[model samples]
Target: MSDENKSKTFLGFDFSTQRLKAVVIDENYEVCHEADVEFDVDLPEFRTSGGVVRGEKGEVTAPTLLWVKALDMVMDRLIVAGVDFSTIEALSGAAQQHGSVWWAKGSKERLKNLSSEDFLHTQLASTFMADSPVWMDSSTSADCRAIEEAVGGPEELAKVTGSRAYERFTGAQIRKMHRTRPRSYSATERISLVSSFACSLFLGEYAPIDLADGSGMNLLDIHSMQWCEEALKACGDEKLSKKLGVPVPSATVVGNISSYFVKRYGFKPDCKVVAFTGDNCSALAGLRLRSGWVGLSLGTSDTLLLGLQEARAPPAGHILVGPTSEAPYMALLCFANGSLTRQSHRDRLVGASWEAFNELLQATVRGNMGYMGIYYDTAEIVPRAVSGRWLYDASGRALDKCAPQFEARALLEGQAIARRVHAEDMGFKLDSSSRVIATGGASVNKELLQIFADVFHTPVYVQDKHANAALLGAAIRAAEVWSVHTNTKLTGSEPSISPVATPYPDSEAIYTPMLERYRQYVDTIPKLQ
Candidate 1:
């Protein structure tokens, strides 16, 4: 570390569903400060539950100005915590993937001409034409179906845009807006993903979507790293292309800090702003994953991220462009029913105790004595299954119920196996050198992690600061971009990680046959429905 660089710091912000978090790291890439603003708690005026408003017909959205206000509040909180904003050389951020923000006609001028005398949210209160449909929204199923059909079919759409048309994707959401809210859609001048919208706040101009995050929307052609015209027509019209602008590489330096931030918050005028990306892509950067390594985030939903040398248009899951050059393509598999499903079963069958749940899991033998089950408390994304629970005996005959220990083990094993299956289908190769970097709320559960290790036939590792991966990733990206633009070197440090679980010797032998049986059971799901 150079003495000249010792005083420099970088900032990373995360605009998540429930809260907005900020992480500051010095030139050494070590965290020095942190702050956050919870939407439901800090911004009560929005009347949001879990940071969003749920309407009829499975619609979920968040007030666009709510995020504007959060940025205002989070910066103030950072200042209150004694962070020296002037010493911050660069900043970047990550946001929940797939949420689209509509900038009303003439809003670009409003963003660029902001004054330091007033708060950002107050000035931009009417900038958006409508609330932003978030990732949790399922109201776009019909739109998704129409898009897939227009583009030939599910497989062809996947080949073009990296995944089959999904309800939460921004393209479908945009299509819904154009159909149901034509006035708002016509009044809109520019459309930004949550990631780019946050970046635009810093740039004081409309920011182009980064390749990594742009891939999440069904509008981008991952193969060409450009917008797909056919896909765009499927969503709306040719004019939609201009509203999206051109996409940029994730690490591109978008611009300098806005004058509003410079005068109001004491930020350096020359501080750079890197293009922001999806939270999952930022987490991938934060973990510093390498070849043969996969990242598992076990939270409200479970997502598996695999870095790919080349893109694969899997029938299930999603493929995104990597944030950094080391990995050019990435595969993502999301399971909608994660911790909540486990908690439900635990509450109903094990006295609502995780310790008891663990005890039950430990008491049961491998493969749950050939008793397998699939549980979805809500609609599942991977297999597209509806809410239901199906259990089977060794011979694959359906059963109404099973032993509590067996039930507990079944849920854990089922989730692990499903992750492995979908990941492999997306071209994830497991071998002796392969390892899983686990993070998120449920990653702390050693018993659950063990099941993942056994099912994937690989060891599992966790970092000391796993929960803040998205925030850290944004900071890392900021530092990387700043270092390149300034021709300065960074004092890099390895993350503090340790292996939490290793596969048993007979793990592969035990779970190999279960994979086929699990698939067979999954095939019978729609029939049973």
Candidate 2:
């Protein structure tokens, strides 16, 4: 590893809610290039009428052509940004989880439309049925419950998937189609996450779902790395389950550089297209966490991530399914409301940027909110649901009725409490022997960092450099390939360390006693209820 020997580059993109972000990095994780794409509703939007019908507030797909256009517009932005697009060797992606992009097999040339809008109109959507049920659409709980009941309830499913079934999961979405939109389910030929869809587009063939993204679906057998027959039978139409594309190892190589590439970015026809993974796994890879290290993803949803030496089943409402372990083994604790609650609600009241939102949180005095004995469990997606329980005696009761800010603080602390409880449930012992890296929207907040420090009681480090570290991590893998494909023999691998993170001592001051009360509430509130 000579300072003179600069490594080659790989490109990484995280296809997140309505956006695709691409980052290019050399072997040492240095940024060489970057770009992005955003999505508008290409599907016929549906609104929920209080669960009256199967309409269930889920928007069907937009014409495939429209999405392809959106993708190209994004690609154009990159070319303008000065990306070499050609010298890049491989294309790997991290996409939003639980999306289903349907493609029918074509002749030797496989004729299809880009999910772009230019080619298809709304009328065409009805014919091709191209929209994917994204993770944000939480309209399938009834279907989730049914699957749970058929499979023997939440605990049983958790034993296999490391997660409790959720409506946005592939299992529920597929089940919904089977029961209500039977025709569509029957007509469906293949389904893959948006990440794999990205890979498939470049492969000039069907792309397999990576283990990291597959576990989100409740259909993948977390342990065996195969689809569970019994789980499929429970959902409906076991035959349709077979159509659920092959389960590929997260690191496996898919065919490289398809016509889509030659047509879109003009990268080399011989470039490799490796397996694409989910955003969470890519984020973990971005940070380059180690065996005992933990990475917290504070996105629309919050996921507590830790790498595993091998795969393990989640006890309940928890999941361990990804190529990050044993080729892609990583466990996750996904809370429905993470930074999203703030993204949705922060504007109306605070009128602050998310960064500024943390600024205000930083201003609050710890334990000084004077609100005692009250924990507002506003969105209790994980841990125990407290329903905004009140805790305290006479003096503390005053602290119970928090202003909007207090409620805001509660949202932050409540999630931390959930993380603590989940970690305990995960059953690992952490000391100085462990390393914790905090990355994501929420982690950037100094106030939240202080609160986290108080809660975790250890120094919290922030990856303050890039907005796309996860994408850069994928690019790092590409650098690995370049080293293998062109340069020398395998060599010593070293750890990737972010700058010694600015300490969250200010957050430490804010969380002091408020954290204690929050913990007390966690223990007594559930029992009291």
- Which candidate number has the best lDDT? 1
Give one digit per residue, the lDDT tens place, for model 1 in 248-361.
999899999999999998898999999999988988888888888999978667889877778878888999999988889888888878876888899999777899889998
Query: Residue 477: error of model 1 in Å?
Result: 0.7
Off by over 4 Å in 2: 1-7, 38-67, 104-130, 325-328, 354-359, 368-380, 384-401, 481-496, 499-529
How high a TM-score does candidate 1 get?
Answer: 0.92
| Candidate 2 residue lDDT tens string, 227-306 | 87767887788686566767877666676676556655667777777788787777777767776667777665777777
Q: Where is the poorest 10-residue window by lDDT in model 1? A: 520-529
TM-score for all models, in order of appearance: 0.92, 0.81
Of the candidates shown, which would achieve the greatest TM-score relative to the real structure? 1
Provide the overall lDDT of each model, using Cα atoms, as 2-decimal numbers. Answer: 0.89, 0.61
Report how far residue 201 has shifted in candidate 2, in Å. 1.8
